[model samples]
Target: MAYRRTPAVQARLDAQREAVLQAAVVLLAERGYGGCSMAAVAERAGIATGSMYRHFSGKSELAVELFRTVVGREVAAVTEAARRESTPQRRLAAAVETFAARALRAPRLAYALLAEPADPVVDAERLVFRRAFRDLFAEQIADAVAAGEIPPQNAELTGAALVGAVGEALVGPLAAGGRHPDEVIPALVSFTLRALGGSHDSDA
Candidate 1:
């Protein structure tokens, strides 16, 4: 028979896991994936190196969890930004602007999430992260087409392309430590608007 954890023990494990994740976030922001070894995270969390195994099977597992934690917050932020907008075209612009602005604010972490070389597991998570943004863009593109804000187009393809374009556009600046947000963000928003074949006057 398998033994079950007591309520107190389960709560303790939950808190420890959160601490481990928090420590990993700090390390990822500072050094990208290369700096997030189990030992380093354990030291940061003030736990034994062996204790990390209690929360994660290995580094790949920890890295994937870390990616999800950070990406979830980003997705929520952009989603909220888009929700506050009054039009499909403006929603798309808001999403792009918010994502670029936040990424620029956290360049090292953004570089890791956007383009860092990492474990195969982390790479797979990156695809999921990209798809989440792709879906968000596709939804607005479809809405825009329905509202006649833009010409009819394949929403999925356009969405995927936009995601790729935004990622590629930001990679250079993010990797270079992203010094020029005021210039970079507006330029990106304009490019996204033109790609969607929508008016940028209101977004401006």
Candidate 2:
């Protein structure tokens, strides 16, 4: 028979796992994926290197989890920013602004998430992350088209293109430590608005 963990033991393990992930986040922010080895994370979390295996099987697994943790927060922020806007164009702008602003605020972390070289597992998670943003933008684009705020277009394709555009536009700045947010963010927002073929007079 398999040995069963008691509730207390299980709770302890869960908390330990959380601590490991938190330590990994700090490492990722500071040094990207290269700095997030199990030993480094274990040291940061005040645990033995071997103990990390209790929470994650290896670096790839930990990297995927870390990517999810960071990306989840980003997605939520963009979603909330979009939710607060009344107009479709405004909602899309808000999402872009929020994403760009947050990325600038955390350049190293953003660089790691956006363009860092990492394991195939993390690359897979990155695709999922991009799709989430694409879908969010597609929803607003569809709305804008329905309301005649923008010309009829393929919302899904446009959404994916916008996601790629934003990511590519930010990659340079993110890699360069996110210089000139005031200039970069507004420029990005304006670009996104123009791409959607919507009026920017109100934003101006």
Candidate 3:
């Protein structure tokens, strides 16, 4: 059924969609995806269960949209945070801190983004996001190599390794009960720098 709306109605609909996403995140965080229900999400959004069906067809679509919404925010924030840092190491560090801090700020959202799996749409969206971050790291590594700050290596390989390392290093700490992000970011930065053949000034 086509649910066309006036401009004002459209705005309200958009707002309702965001609320659904938020509610879905809460549900996924509190109860794993298998346990969450569309009716529950609708209730959380303060909308009737029937109204949510107008926006999302099923559990998969709702979860995918939530994945896109929450993880997209993290990816965008990380990209923005690392924009000023030129060195590959610093850029990698910025990326790590961005993920860690954001994860802590939204633990359930972070879990849904990193640890949990969504539908096929979510998987495709995640792959696109992962590649974007990989490209960003590759660019930084290229710059660092150009400046003679690091050993020469294939940018893609280097980027993949760093991205993997970042995920491995931060995921546990971010998810660890009672763990704070500020404490982990510096350690993460230092470790990644060393893994990248250490900085130029470190040996002196």
Candidate 4:
């Protein structure tokens, strides 16, 4: 006969799963992928090491899941910020600021997500978020071009360039765990606006 969990038992299991995932996130942020082993996560989560496999097949699966969770949250934030403003230029500025600001606020996590070398699975997951970010920029660029806010440009190429430029610029700062060093968001906003031929008169 098949067995079904009682409501109370299922709730406990759900809470345990959340605790395990949270523990993994903290460990990953604190020590990068290399330091976040299944045993370590289990220990941090106050569960038996063997139990981790019940939640995740292995370290790779856990790492990939964590990557998706973390990067997905970041992408949502950037998307929301980008769509908040009416003008495409303002939306682009907001996107840049939101992305940079989040990275600055959580340098360890940001560095781990953006710059740390990881297993191929996790690297592929990183690429997914990178593309998501590029797409956000592409949408704004297309809109701005249509509205005559910026000159005609290859939106895809330009979006990729922006993502690469922004990620590269933040790597060193993120590695050093610096917060809002020298008005990074403003400088980035100004630089991005200028690069896209958008007006830089308004502060981002």
Top-scoring candidate (lDDT): 1
Model 2, span 1-204: residue lDDT tens? 999999999999999999999999999989998999999999999999999999889999999899999999999999999999899999999999999999988899998888998888989999999999999999999999999999999999999999999999999999888899999998888998888888872562
lDDT of 4 at 82: 80
> What does the lDDT read for residue 108 in candidate 4?
86
* Cα lDDT tens digits for candidate 1, 51-167: 999999999999989999999999999999999999899899999999999999999999999899987999899999999999999999999999999989999999999999999
Runs off by more than 4 Å, candidate 1: 201-204
Location of the lowest summed lDDT over 10 successive residues in candidate 3: 195-204
Q: Worst lDDT window (10 residues) for model 1?
A: 195-204
Model 1 CA lDDT for position 66: 98
Candidate 4, RMSD to the unseen true structure: 1.8
Per-model TM values vs. the true structure = 0.97, 0.97, 0.80, 0.92
lDDT for position 118 in model 2: 86
Q: Every model's Cα RMSD, please? A: 1.1, 1.1, 3.3, 1.8
TM-score of 3: 0.80
Off by over 4 Å in 2: 201-204
| Clash pairs for candidate 1 | none
lDDT of 3 by residue, 19-123 (tens): 888888778677656546899998888899999987999887887777667667777888888886666567666776676677676665555555565567766
Q: What Cα-based lDDT does every candidate model obtain?
A: 0.94, 0.92, 0.72, 0.88
Error of 1 at 40 (Å): 0.5
**Rank order by lDDT, top first?**
1, 2, 4, 3
**Number of backbone collisions per candidate, in order?**
0, 0, 0, 0
